[model samples]
Target: MSIYLTAILKSKKDKIQDLKSILDNMVLNTKKEEACEKYELQQSLDDEAVFIFHEIWKSKEGLDAHNQQPYIQEFVEKVPDLLEKPAEIYLAKLV
Candidate 1:
């Protein structure tokens, strides 16, 4: 079955622009993966520092492979310093 993910990220007040740039690059790179069905990056209008990623994968295994990608790893490693808090991730299935 396909897997869906919603990830919420909050950038440090001063680092919002930088985080946005990084996320843009991530989206560009991740969309090239074979099993990526959908990937979107959205920024909150109410709170510019808050961003969300909505992703759909062919399967859980595809999502797992995405996590291991170098761009994803780089994002993980760089986010701590730029983010206000840890990312909030939700995994879901169709009803």
Candidate 2:
């Protein structure tokens, strides 16, 4: 089954640019990832605190591999300090 993830992030005011850069890198890397089907980021129109992310992978292994990627590893290290709270992630399977 395909792997799906929806993440909600709250950006800190001082880290807005850093978060944007991270998202940009993620977008580029995910497009190049072999098993990626879709990976996208969307900003909330009404709430400056909100960032919405969607990810799709060919399989659970693909998702796991994506998590282990270098940039993603770096992001994991950097993200906690850049956000108002920990990112809220939900895993899903297609109906």
Candidate 3:
């Protein structure tokens, strides 16, 4: 089964741009990773304060590798300070 994740982030008014910037960088870098099947950042059309990340990895190990990547760690650390609420990350297995 493929590994998938949906992450929701609600950015503070002042950090919306910063959140986008960071996510943009992470998306670009993620595409280069061996385990990344798909990595996308989406802005909420109805709510400008919301950002969504859709990610697909090759396997559980691949997802783990992605989590351990330095930039991923950095991105995770940066999100809390940039958001109005804590970011929510969901992990799923393709059926």
Candidate 4:
């Protein structure tokens, strides 16, 4: 079964561009994964500091593998200093 994930990330003051650059790189790399069904990044029109990700993975194991990726780890390491708060993530399945 596929897994759906949505993540919301908020940037710290003056860090929108920096965070966006990182997110853009994430999208670039993540989309290349064989198990990635979808990986979309969107910026908020109302708030420049807010960014959102919509993703679908082929399986939970695939997502688990994605979490272990070096690029993902790098992004996580940068989160504390660049973000306003920890990322808010939601998981869903089709009813």
Best candidate, lDDT-wise? 1
In model 4, where do residues sit more than 4 Å from their true spots? none
- What is the clash count of model 4? 0
Which candidate, 3 or 4, would have the higher TM-score against the true structure?
4
Tens digits of per-residue lDDT, candidate 1, 1-95, equal 99999999999999999999999999999999999999999999999999999999999899999999998999989999999999999999999
Comparing 1 with 2 on TM-score, the higher-scoring candidate is: 1
Clash count for each candidate, listed in order shown: 0, 0, 0, 0
Ranking by TM-score: 1, 4, 2, 3
lDDT of each: 0.96, 0.90, 0.88, 0.93
Q: After superposition, how far is residue 16 of candidate 1 from its true place, in Å?
A: 0.5
Ordering by lDDT: 1, 4, 2, 3
| Per-residue C-alpha lDDT of model 2 across residues 1-95, encoded as one tens digit per residue | 99899999999988888898998898988889999999999999997668999988899999998999999998999998899999999999978
- Candidate 2 lDDT (Cα, 0 to 1): 0.90
Estimate the TM-score of every prediction.
Answer: 0.97, 0.94, 0.92, 0.97
Error of 2 at 50 (Å): 1.5
RMSD of each: 0.6, 0.9, 1.1, 0.6
Error of 3 at 69 (Å): 1.4
